[model samples]
Target: MNSEQRKFEIWRHKMVARQIVARGITDPGVIAAMETVPRHLFVSEALTDSAYGDFPLPIGEAQTISQPYIIAEMTQALELTGDERVLEIGTGSGYQAAVLAEIVFRVYTIERNNILFLRTRKLFDALKYHNIVARYSDGTLGWKEEAPFDAILVTAGGTQIPQPLLDQLAVGGRLVMPVGGLCSQELVRIEKKADKITTDNLGGCRFVKLIGEHGWKE
Candidate 1:
């Protein structure tokens, strides 16, 4: 088998199947995508050994690669069908975007941190994941030019769902985000249907602050 395949097998056993999936991820597609992606590539060289570990790790610039379970859970929550255009609000490490790319038609990810934007762009290019479009910008504005997204995912914490992002959601589109201050937050799922919107609280989570216009105060 090729090295990539071997790495995938190791990831399946060591990360997804043995750790995340077994721990109740329940989404087979998410598990498969997590298994196949080489997560180590997204992390810094110093953290390579713990790449497959079931925990978050710092990825520089006061950001971190979300824990593997969180990634799987959030991706699965979107209920993707491999045909929707997904907008990811934070592209830290590009790990989440990579996972979404494997399951969606295309991904447009925005990172407010310039360093992270450049680094993630290079990583996506090197991995030949052409479907992901990475940009350095304020994620809370929801990339208005590319509105009507099939799905929108905010990876950072904010005080509330940004109105612009809500406006950008396509009719029947789903938006998943963490809302609250730095010390506490709730993971919320919002579904838009025409002019009506329904929201559900998924659970609690802690994420870096999303700083930008329409996001947290500077």
Candidate 2:
């Protein structure tokens, strides 16, 4: 690898170690995915230097790529063993979905902002992430055509878990998202069991508002 590539590789490893592993993320697949994905390519040119930092960065359209730890946390919460169809609600910078793509069979992500949708789609294509399928639409409604996802991840915060997402989750699947008011929210993981559904609060988190028919009104 070239010098610049080597530098980013070192930074990526540090992010996986200090930010992810130190924070108690134990999923080997999640860690491997975090290290493999080129986070710098997911941000604007000006913000590329800070892509591996332990924080979020603006990716235009009022959206931000989530922090590495949070991404790792949410991904690990899915308990993926690979080879499962995943659904992501909010493509954002496409960073989260890329990370998922590295460890899952396939990822279907939706973005409400047309600009972000188009931009991220190009990025995914250029990176040769063929396993990631993206669409521009209301993510809150979920992808009914591809219903019964093995796992679902919502990148934005809503007043509550969108019912469509819950309905689309397959039995024994896990769905993680931030739910609460617009300003701040709590990270929750929903497990669709055979008989009943259970919710677990991962902790507090803040994300951009999820706007759609089932989410906050735009």
Residue 112's lDDT in candidate 1: 88
lDDT of all predictions: 0.89, 0.95
Quote the positional error of residue 172 for candidate 2 in Å: 0.8
Looking at model 2, residue 11 earns an lDDT score of 95
lDDT by residue for model 1 over 1-218, one digit each (tens)? 99866865676568887777777887777877897788988998888878888789999998999998889878988989889999999899999999999889999999988999999999999999999998888888888888789999999999989999999999999999999988989999999997689998989999998888888876
In model 2, which residue pairs have backbone atoms overlapping below 3 Å? none
TM-score for each of the candidates: 0.94, 0.99
Clashing pairs in 1: none
- Give, for candidate 1, the lowest lDDT window spanning 10 residues: 4-13
- lDDT string, candidate 2, 1-218, tens digits: 99999999999999999999999999999999999999999999999899999889998888899999999999999999998999999999999999999999999999989999999999999999999999999999999999999999999999899889999999999999999997899999999999999999999999999999998998
User: Which number leads on TM-score?
Assistant: 2
Give the distance in Å from residue 164's predicted Cα in candidate 2 to where it truly belongs: 0.9
Regions more than 4 Å wrong, model 1: 1-8
